[model samples]
Target: MQTEPNSNPNGQDVLLPPDGDDVPRVQDLDLNLLKAFHAVYVEKNVGRAALRLGMTQPSVSHALSRLRLVFRDALFVRTPGGVEATPRAQRLAGSIDRVLRILQDMLDEGAQFCAATSRRVFRLHMSDFAESAFLPTLMRELDTRAPGVVIETHHIEDSQFNMAIESGRIDFALGHFPHASSHFHFSELLQERYVLLMARRVARRLELDEHFTLGLNAPDGLHFIAVTSHPQATELLERYGLTSRVRLAVPNFMVVPAILSRCDYALIVPHTVARAFSTPGDSAMFEIDDASTWPVNAYWHRRFDADPGHRWLRGLLMELFRIGAREPFDSWLGAPLDLAPDSAHNA
Candidate 1:
């Protein structure tokens, strides 16, 4: 049988003389591969490491091959049962384990956020109405500190709201929730109040009782051109005893002012949304103060609760919305800042 010299309690070889360059040095190795090596050691299988890395099995095999060359030994030997660590690998086990842990900690810390150097992409769900008021502020924040990060918005619809989030089709949805789903986690974002969008001249002439009679039955099926990215019109109509006789329905909110210019039609939207739709033109938005308030929320799949990327996005949103802060009543929406916890809950 082949035998090797044993080490003393002080980790010094007892049988061989000390060599000049025998000290362990990690500087020469590719530090990036440490994550892959750690995964392999923990799983004890190449296939699992590949899955964890979101790579192909062959790719993991190739990385392992490279690790062997760097370590100058077959770190793991295939036996009748499982891969076993060799003497050199055994000596490395402790140090490699610590190195892998430190690397993971660094990655986790980096993800925690340093706006100056971060380039994270945050996927958010919102309606065109919410986007009109919030996107500008969010963009300003992105350009300042989190300049490298980009936001991908998902417009939430009543038909697919539940499935889209539960199945991971999107990262998170921001809007009202009729009921909670088992597959998702919900956090309150803000309260949305209904409003009316009409020509300023028409707004002045219509009495409060006849406010619903702008040639539109309610909010959805109106005789005038309507530009809506979400179902806020339909929702607003449902709250009141009205129904819209929609003649035109466009998907973008930016087109509303143009559409409402020639036609004598109006749109019933959220107050914040109406503010966004307001411009120096023939049409403008008016708050429907009598309409019921809807609670808006941020929802995500339960499965993503533990993911690092998902958590990062969730935290960023909470910071942006200041979840407890009340919606601004000063009109044009305020700067993106934290809302006090006590006042954030009310609409």
Candidate 2:
């Protein structure tokens, strides 16, 4: 049988000789071979990496053996849990992943995509705002169009946008982020004004009280629930002289609706988010006086600009959320594969 002499032989590793001028060059490695190297490096286990690459354990071991000889390093050493990368492998990880993304982009640039049958899993970094205002509609639309497709959402910090998109950790992000960036493309979805929300009972009490006026400002003596995810909430509180009146501070808006219902704490949120949480009959919403607005945006790295899948998803999102879009998003300019069988099976 053909074999890598230094690969696991008789189920045991065999160390290789020293590197020489005969070492394999980068061009000597094919895309699949480099993929094997990357999978093992990231997964830190041969069997698991093999599963990720859809190959047998022995095949992955053979590929690893070739990679070790090519790079002239042990690359990884066995650990009780899995494997630990050597310094060289650690250093190679970034460039290898970047190369893979670039090559995938190049391939997808000209590839025809059949969303009706494609079972691609897209990753997105969504803020709580997007989760509330965008996810439900986007998912419902996807369900009708691509039943086999899936979405995995990540909660990431604004600072991680560039690396997250470039590393393929996230395909798209929707949040309030600084627009000035050389590496990212930002599209504004909504630049909504700030509004306050409270339980319906509380609005009734405020309306009957003789203290407030039309287009009411925040009245004195009410506590506030501050969502840390929207820093503008805090800024608005400070602007309204209610900083010390903040009763509770939470990381996200997930529980704000419940809190508003159970307590008299006022919630300062973007008009879009407030719309999602506000009950027309049961919740009171007041437009607070301020030019201060929260901007929701979609961000992606420039490196993925040409990827067909990436472009398709981005265009779908833009059409789904942008204020004036009337049609279902479709970026596929060319004819799609005849995927009737696949669609029938997946459905």
Model 2 worst lDDT window (10 residues): 327-336
**Across residues 1-347, which tens digit of lDDT does each residue of candidate 1 receive?**
23335332222333333334455357646764666666766676766777898887677666655665555555665544445566776787788789877888988874565666777676677766667767776687669867788789876667877777777777887766675476678887677776667765444344323333332234443344444555656655545545445667777777776666666666766666665555543444544545667777778888888776677667766777654555543422543222111122222
The estimated TM-scores of all candidates read: 0.55, 0.58
lDDT scores in order: 0.61, 0.72
Residue-wise C-alpha lDDT for candidate 2, range 36-145, written one tens digit per residue:
88998888889899999999988988887777767877777877788888898899889989999999887775786677997999998887877787877888889998
**How much is the lDDT of residue 74 in candidate 1?**
58
Q: Which one is best on TM-score?
A: 2
Root-mean-square deviation of every model = 13.6, 18.6
lDDT score for residue 233 of model 1: 63
Those runs of model 2 whose alpha carbons end farther than 4 Å from true positions after fitting are 1-109, 208-217, 324-347
Best by lDDT: 2
Candidate 1, superposed: residue stretches over 4 Å from native: 1-113, 155-163, 177-180, 204-252, 260-265, 280-290, 306-308, 323-325, 329-347
Question: Measured by TM-score, how close is model 1 to the native structure?
Answer: 0.55
TM-score of 2: 0.58
